[model samples]
Target: MVAKSAKLTQLIQAVDGQKVHQIRCGDHRFIDVTIVQTQGRFFVRQYKFSKRSWYDAFINNPTIDGLPNGAMKIGDLEVQINGKVPEDLQSMTPSVNQAYRKLLGLVYPLMRLTFDRQKHEATTLELIPVFDH
Candidate 1:
């Protein structure tokens, strides 16, 4: 299940304007990530497939101590994963690409390189506020 509308709003507001945040997985692991919001949905992309301990940890043990599979933290805000959102590799919107490039501050060739890397190697996951019970 996705977050309740109000909680989702709050979560989006909390993270608004922030490009990078720490994502906590398992009980004591945290990794710095760049978060992007497009169409009012939050996404985190793994730039390098080689460095995927965090992703591995989340997938292998998404939750601990009775938490949901999606339970995780972004910065100080608690959130849940909505699994991996499908990326339309062939049709990435300009705005979305721009958002990522801005967050990364990459120049022409580097931007192209990173974008290609993302297309070929990275995983994009949608994040939602933890559902309220």
Candidate 2:
């Protein structure tokens, strides 16, 4: 659900470094990701899913860059994901899985049956707060 009172910046701050956020875009299903504060800016890591990556789904559309207005949540609290797999993805998966184990455990098992790690790409989604319409 889209938050009516919470600004994107506030929401980012609320979850940054402390918790994981699940974000859903357009008609896509929700995925648990994090809001990382890096190099004095914020970014969301999007992993490539089996068939398509977040970058693949939204890159062609210019509307996503602006991310206008509100952000989405699942049942009150959650976040977003993005991008293609990185070159070092194999190395990264172990830690990524551990950090998000509580969340991933529920979905990873079923996903492992059909999900091939090599099929996806890792990319970053820079979160720029769009305050006004």
Candidate 3:
């Protein structure tokens, strides 16, 4: 794991309680994402197969112009991505997943987010923080 810089730590604390935030993949436009912070790490799960562009983007090219290709922006602070979490440790806790489902219901009342634990577990991606130099 990369050491967390003061800026990165502050950014994590600032958004840890929030259910949703905007993330940008490479040069793609920012998209609303459900983020969760656990074990001093941040994670984003692909709730649906159709919404896998961000994941695909990262896998295709994790870096661009020698800089990280992904980022999560919270106001003026941006947390750079180190890379995806390994498959073995990608799954979030059940409670965390339940909370995410509740958040989705509140955030998108018209849309129904399914509760397929297996699928969600497979889609979870940890946002390893890139420490500032």
Candidate 4:
């Protein structure tokens, strides 16, 4: 719906027809992204610009090349996790309760994005996408 990044707009247009599509995270889950076509459709992963770890070992190590895979396949859409709270809520500290709630709110779109990975077009969050919708 809303195009925040010109790169993303170009990606969607890059493979404007056919069926299956995918994008690669070259730098990390945040920095580099390249769109690829499978049969025809488009796919996008979650990435952020700030998450790139400029460390040597994680970057130079051959085994640790080209971003961690956080793009979960649901159907058509990929749930690109730019960041996530690795620990379960039950195990969270009491002081982080506010943070936990905020996280849930942030991840709600991601949860819906799950359906997109599955190629389910009926994806909707409480019957809404944008707040102004």
Candidate 5:
């Protein structure tokens, strides 16, 4: 018989081992593969159940140059892995911000998977922008 626990170990384990990597795209662009911060690192790793792991990927750093113009991508998706949340997001490199906003859209499903904020608070301190991708 299964254990008398409401929690399954697989889900718990999956939520404990997510990962990401980074790489440089040509001269100015830096690429990344990041797990959402709210998910607790390694808790919801990308690729879910793919062959390669984060250790097998490139871990790029935050780019600030014209890198966004040439941001890295996998398949049809551009990686908008911002290493830091800038204090003034608008003052950010337009391209990177654009890239990030593009990425922000994709995170909706992932974000919904974890937490649902109170509508009011969620709307109030919103700083992240959206892109038309």
Candidate 6:
């Protein structure tokens, strides 16, 4: 199992306590991420802000660098994107879809006017915590 940093542990606790909605990286970047823990394992979901899908980029090049270091690196962490896709594909819940809509609405009001459900499902990148073997 990969080790979880003290800072990350604290941040997770705070998030679970409903204290924060975003995570800060070592590069001093704040990303809106949803922390998920199941069966005693931790995971993170990162939203893609670019108009173009990162699916191709991630698939073509899995090794990633410049990961934000909030709890963990705070400025020195290189990560790999294990998997990425729209969250709706993972959880077919109306609420999740609605939440994505609301999030998009906040950024691009024009998106709220029309609904191309399949085309613009919120792009979510799923990161699994792992320790080097």
TM-score, per-candidate, Cα-based: 0.63, 0.45, 0.70, 0.19, 0.20, 0.36
Every candidate's CA RMSD: 4.7, 7.4, 4.6, 15.8, 17.5, 7.6
Compared with the true structure, the alpha-carbon lDDT of candidate 3 equals 0.65
Q: Over all chains combined, what TM-score does candidate 6 have?
A: 0.36
- Is candidate 2 or 6 superior in TM-score? 2
**lDDT of all predictions, in order shown?**
0.58, 0.48, 0.65, 0.30, 0.31, 0.40
For lDDT, candidate 1 versus 2, the one ahead is 1
lDDT of 6: 0.40
Error of 5 at 81 (Å): 6.1
Question: 20-97 in candidate 1: lDDT tens per residue?
Answer: 666655455557776666667666666656655556555566444444445445556776554344455335445456
Q: Give the Cα error of residue 80 in candidate 6, in Å.
A: 4.8
Across residues 1-133, which tens digit of lDDT does each residue of candidate 2 receive? 4563465555545655355665554566766666444333344555544457545555443354644322445346443323323345556545545444433456656665665544422454544344443
lDDT of 4 by residue, 5-84 (tens): 54344433443432233322233433232222222222222322235432221223322232343332223544332222
Off by over 4 Å in 3: 1-4, 63-67, 90-113
Write one digit per residue (lDDT tens) for candidate 5, span 72-127. 23333333322233344344334332333344667645654664333311211111
Best by TM-score: 3
Model 4 lDDT-worst window of ten: 122-131
Worst 10-residue lDDT window, candidate 5: 121-130
Query: Which parts of model 4 are misplaced by more than 4 Å?
Result: 1-4, 23-133
Error of 5 at 15 (Å): 12
**What is the lDDT, from 0 to 100, of the residue 68 in candidate 2?**
39
